[model samples]
Target: MDAAAEPVRRSPPWRDLLAPGLATLVCLAILLALGTWQLQRKAWKEGVIRQVVERSRIDPPLAPPAAGTWDPAADEFKRVRITGRLLNDRETLVHGLAPGEAPGRALQGYYVLTPLVREDGPPILINRGFVPTELRNPRDRAAGEVAGPVTVTGILRASEERGLFVPAPDPQRGEWFNRDIPGIAAARGLTEVAPYLIEADATPNPGGWPRGGQLRVDLPNNHLQYAFTWYGIALCLVGVFSAYAWKRLREVA
Candidate 1:
C-alpha cells in the first residue's frame, strides 16, 4: 500500500492550532452591537423630530407660561405668544447679517434684541433679525429704534450656546462683542426677563423699520444617516471575516 493511500495520521486543526480566533469573533460581535446601538439612537431622534413638528404646527401662540413656570430645560423651543410693548430705546444690536439693507452684502450687522414687556407676563427678548454693518456701531445701535406695544408671536429660542470665531466684543475695552443674550440683558438693565428669546413668524409688520417675522424652525436630523454608516461598516466587516475564514480553511485543507 502506498504510504499516502494508508491513513496518514494528521493532527486535528484544534489540536495543532494556537489561534486567538475567539478574539476576532468578539471584535465582530462588538461592531454589530455598536451598529445596533446607533439604530436605536436613530429611532430616538426620529421620535423627537416628530414631536417637535407636532408642537410647531400649534396655531395661535398660547398665553405665556405663568410666573415661576419658566423651566429652561423644559421651555426650550416651546411655541409661545407675547402680548407686550417693545421698549424702543432699549434695543441691543448684536452681530448678525441682513443683505437687503445699508450694509449691502454679507457683512456683519446688528441683531436688534428688544425687550417685549408683556402686559401681565414675563418680558421675553425679541430678536427682530439682522440690520446692517452700519448699524453695528454703538451710535448706530443707539440711533436705530423699535417702538410701542406690539403683539409679537414667535417661537421661543434657546440662547446661542456657540460663539463666533471672530473676537468677542470687549465691553471693558469698549467694544461690542458677541451676541450673548444674558450679557446683552445685563448691559441694557432688563428686568423680570425670560431666559429665552423670540424669533418672529411670517406675520407682516406694517410700518416696518426693523422687519418682524423671520423665525427659522429648520432642524437637521442626521441620526438616520449616522446609523446607516455604522450598519454598513458592520456588514463590510462581516464580509471580511467570512473571506478570511474561507481562505484559512483552504490553507488548512
Candidate 2:
C-alpha cells in the first residue's frame, strides 16, 4: 500500500498573530521614537557649538555687561574686557582637571578664582587659571598677585552646578570642588557680586603661576551614532519576526 499522503501545512490564521503583531508594532514605534529624538538633539548641539565659536572668538573684547543687566544665557561665552583691581586676599581655589599635552591625560589641580574689585560695579569673580597642587598656597605664587589696577580680557562663563558626587565646599579649610558662585561670595563676605565669572585668557601674569586661558568648550555629540544603533536594532527585530512567522507557516503536519 502507498504511504499515507502527508497532510498539507498552511499559514496560521491572522487572529493567531494579533497579539504578537501588536507587541512587535509597539516595540518598533518605541525604537523609532528614540531614534528621532536623538536626531533632534544632534541639531540642537550643533547650534550650541556654532554659537560658542562665534561668541568666544570675537576680536577686541566687548565691554563687560553692566551688573543686573547681564543674562547668563545671552552673555555666557562672550569675550569681554573689564578693568579692575585684584582682591587677592579673598581668592577661592576650586578643584578641577586641566587637559595635558598627551591625549587622554589630565593634570589635577585647582582653578584660582580671585574677586576683581571694579570701581564701576560690584566685585566680579575672575578665574585666573589652573595652578598645580604645589602652588595652591598664595605664598607659592605671590608675585602673580599684582598689587595695582589691571585690565582683564577673557570669556564670560556661568557658575558651575555641583554634581551628585561632588564634595561639599569647606570655607574654613578653603576646599572647594565646584565653582558655587553664591556660596563662594557669601563665604568670602562679598555682597552683590557678579552672577557670572570670567575665565581669563592666556595673558602672562607677573609670576606665571596661575596659568590662564583654560576656557574649554568640548561638548560631546554622539547622537547620530545612537540613532543608527536604535534603528539597527529595530531592523533586526523585524527580520527575526519575519523568519519566525515563515517557519511556523512551513511546518509539516
Best by lDDT: 2
Candidate 1 structure quality by residue, lDDT tens digits, 163-234: 557666655543454556677677778766776787776565443445555455546767667767777876
Model 1 TM-score, all chains together: 0.74
Error of 2 at 199 (Å): 0.7
Determine which window of 10 residues in candidate 2 has minimal summed lDDT.
244-253
Candidate 2 structure, TM-score to reference: 0.91
- Model 1 lDDT at residue 25: 67
lDDT of 2 at 119: 82
Residue 13 of candidate 2: its Cα lDDT? 62
| Tens digit of per-residue lDDT, candidate 2, span 127-154 | 9999988898999999998889999999
Most accurate candidate by TM-score: 2
Q: Assess the local accuracy of residue 125 in candidate 2 as a C-alpha lDDT between 0 and 100.
A: 96
Please list the C-alpha lDDT of all candidates, in the order they appear.
0.65, 0.90
